[model samples]
Target: MKIFYPLIFSIFLFCYEISGQYYPSQEWERKSASSLNMSQPLLDSAINIASQNENAVNRDLRIAIIEAFSREPYFEILGETKERGGPAGLIIKDGYIVGEWGDIKHVDMTFSVAKSYLSTVAGLALDKKLIHNIDDKVYEYVWDGTFDGSHNKKITWDHLLTQSSDWSGQQFGLYDWADRSPREGEIDDWRARKLYEPGTHYKYNDVRVNVLAYSLLQVWRKPLPQVLKEKIMDPIGASTTWRWLGYHNSYVNVDGIKVQSVSGGGHFGGGIFINTLDHARFGLLFLRNGKWVEKQLISKDWVKSVQKSSKAKSDYGYLWWNNSQGSWEGVSKEVYYAAGFGGNYIIIDEANDLVIVSRWIDNSKIDDVVRLVQNSIK
Candidate 1:
């Protein structure tokens, strides 16, 4: 019986492996010849430049870098690095990795970086006319009694993308609320009411993005994860070892009824975790105007729209940060990025076809890193 038990366990493990239900080993393998060739000389030059930066060796910088690895919150979360720790990052210059740090195999959380990726998805949906336009009302698709009455009717897709929705306050607080209660009412109330006219003001709110996620799901009649895998992830050949947090919960309204919801329900929020190399690949697509290996992954026009500044916020577009160091002395005006909390970043310079990905420990000195990189570029 003991021998039979061991044999049964071995068979079960074999079946699990065949079914792709087990975690693969962390052996780092080069993506492909084409993907690898994207960053040769540029990476060499970047490494040379990075080696010379005083901040790279300075005590404060070194401490900050270490703390980033520890995911401390003493440092402010700016750019892609959030309060939470991020995954490894890949830097690509002229479509090739100039440098990489952290584990290339371990997937890191993308935080708001997911927002930028989702924006790309939105672009594709727009191309398919699944989403008509930026100005299309969100309620057009989510018309299920989830949101009803006055302010709900006024919310539009643009409002969510621009973070100009009236419910920004609730959305902002929803994160904290979710941490306390993972129940359905926790989410519904977060997106329950309109605090102001949609698009009249700008407020950074995660809930608005959640609303966008919900709308996309409804339009496609599938979950956001599945949609991404089919539309974006598979085509780009991104690492399959990634996960999207959030999108599961029920919200209870003031009326005390359970609302079936699958949007941004988590308070702290979730991100798309990916490895550094895969991130570089994703950044390469953006750098090439949404083309991957000569194939158009997303419409060029849609890419342009997402990269351009929205009317609501001069420094924000769709889900991308227009310029983290826009006004900084050394930062290039042409630089735009997909930034997340805990320093997870994919910084792209479209004009120069440069992409810099950095996954740092949470709460690192992002400003210094940004400054150092900017100075190096100069």
Candidate 2:
């Protein structure tokens, strides 16, 4: 019976892989709130809720980063950042826009939301057999000094995806120790901290994330932005204005050609700078199980994998945030999201066929806004 079930599941997945793709038009289809079986008054209330509460950190994003690091301006360290934009959002129900607010066309730095995009890139690599398995030791592919030590050598692709790698190294001129260091630790204590066994400790460190990016660049032998554009973005009809950027110093020699390795977020500087419409488009691709207009942009299996919680953090998936705790009232625990700094979220609720892209919203009010949208459905 077990053998029979395994074959059945494999056949089901194979069928999904070959199914025809679905893609959105250049302009998202718009429908009246009531036409979508949503209450107009309740939909208006939800939009109002988003518009009323702006992100508390919107006054100066640069100052927030500076304060976190207790250092000089980020421009001096990480280089130029795309200008941060004001609150913007889109509510897509069954692939059509039912609600939208703020400047949907404005492009801004999306911060760590790019990590999910990076995760998708890794997924593509996995599908192509460039990586045999997520559990494979990264050192096997990246023979450079990045994973030479005993501790780092134990790190696998899974650890890096789950933010549990504890990879001890520097990349793109940023030391792993210096990123998001504990506020109470002494300088030496923070710098020489004990390395937790890889996959045991989860720390959100951009240096390690950038190292993962650089490692993937070595595996891909080309610029990541180009790969993303060709494989995922262009097929899904993403805007040209959206850019996945890397630090100024992140370029490295790959096969005698210098290729830039992009950052996972805008912590230091340079992540994905995109508009809300493009964000919605990306979110819809996942909502549709990675299929886009007669082609599978990313494997359905990869989409399923990203939603599964990691052992190190139940609330986090592969660069995506999970709602396992159901903190958001009326939202399903099955809902997962790609979240970035400054309240950027691409919340996907497959059960409801909904995609909510919220930018620059107050973090505390996100749940309420989501609940409001859920309540509108009648």
Candidate 3:
């Protein structure tokens, strides 16, 4: 990919400062593929590959949730679930829409892509000094019994962000070990296993992820949805249609107000229900290093940190999936994305000045989509 070509993109906003590019308002500007110096045929192929290769996740998300976690002990959807639409996506080059297909305005469950949004909130907290440091023990801020245990006491904000907490506990009636138990082990044996030192093990458990959400709620002293909306979403000109939801039982009293603690992903159910356009806006924010026009909404340091690999998992970062360890073969190692169930994604290619959002595509086609999109540039 000619990552530098976007700075000199022939389409629009040319000859401006490197950081100065289009910022969408209610209506986003569009440019044809050929005008952007991209092969329209190749761009069309990328969109067709995404729109045609629909994922197998059921439209009735309740059933989809059930089938997904069927192996978990007594797994149940504790939050609201919505039926999803067909494949939809957007391809933005130089902050302008270059290629799009399917129902881009249709709101759908983005699943774990919400985790990356959660990471943004954490970065905001750090920027505001609410979180003094990333490595600070979470127990310091959340003095409650949540992180009281010996094992969980060592868990820092970084650990939770990277899914390396190995925090053992229950939240909103969901058990940590029960969420994704080793299929080979018996239920009794799974719980009896030794806990890995905090930040040493990488396990993808939604219950643990929600624990991070709950901890952040304590630190922010308000609803995380509020933090996200004010600090990230609104500044980027995102629509009001998006919703960040949690389980029915996830509400907690904070500052004399009942605020629902949001989830990092829709594991049991209830995450971000957002349209493809909004997702594109979010990716564009990261592509611009958390800036919106003249304002640096979030620190570039934090933005760069999210792309770095975590010690526990080389392909993982602060709730963001990184390509640093080459998780996707032949794809740029600089690319990082938020991937979710049912093939949802918000892919950020900063080096190329691109943001791509796709929903309900086949999981296996993402690499090809990236390759084709990158190859489209001249």
Q: Which candidate number would show the highest lDDT if scored against the true structure?
A: 3
What is the model-wide C-alpha lDDT for candidate 2? 0.84
In candidate 2, stretches whose alpha carbon ends up further than 4 angstroms from where it belongs are: 1-22, 71-76
On lDDT, who's better, 1 or 3?
Answer: 3
Cα lDDT tens digits for candidate 3, 1-378: 688787656544442224468777678989998888999888999998998999998999989989888778878888889998999999999999999999999899989999999999889999999999999999999987988888989999999999998999888888899988978458788889899998888999889889999989998998888889988888888999999999899899998999999988888899999999999999988998888777899999999999998999999999999788776777889999999999999999887888999999898998899889998999
Model 2, span 212-255: residue lDDT tens:
88888988899999999999888888899998888788778989
Instruction: Report the C-alpha lDDT of model 1 over 173-226, residue by residue, as the tens digit.
Output: 243123222245455655453366877777765556776765676676655667
TM-score of decoy 1: 0.67
Q: Residue 329 deviation, candidate 2, in Å?
A: 3.5
TM accuracy, model 2: 0.91
Candidate 3: which stretches are off by over 4 Å? 1-20
Best-to-worst order by lDDT is 3, 2, 1
Candidate 3: clashing residue pairs, number: 0
Count of steric clashes across candidates, in order: 23, 1, 0
Q: Is candidate 2 or candidate 3 better by TM-score?
A: 3
By summed lDDT, which 10 consecutive residues of candidate 3 come out lowest?
Answer: 10-19
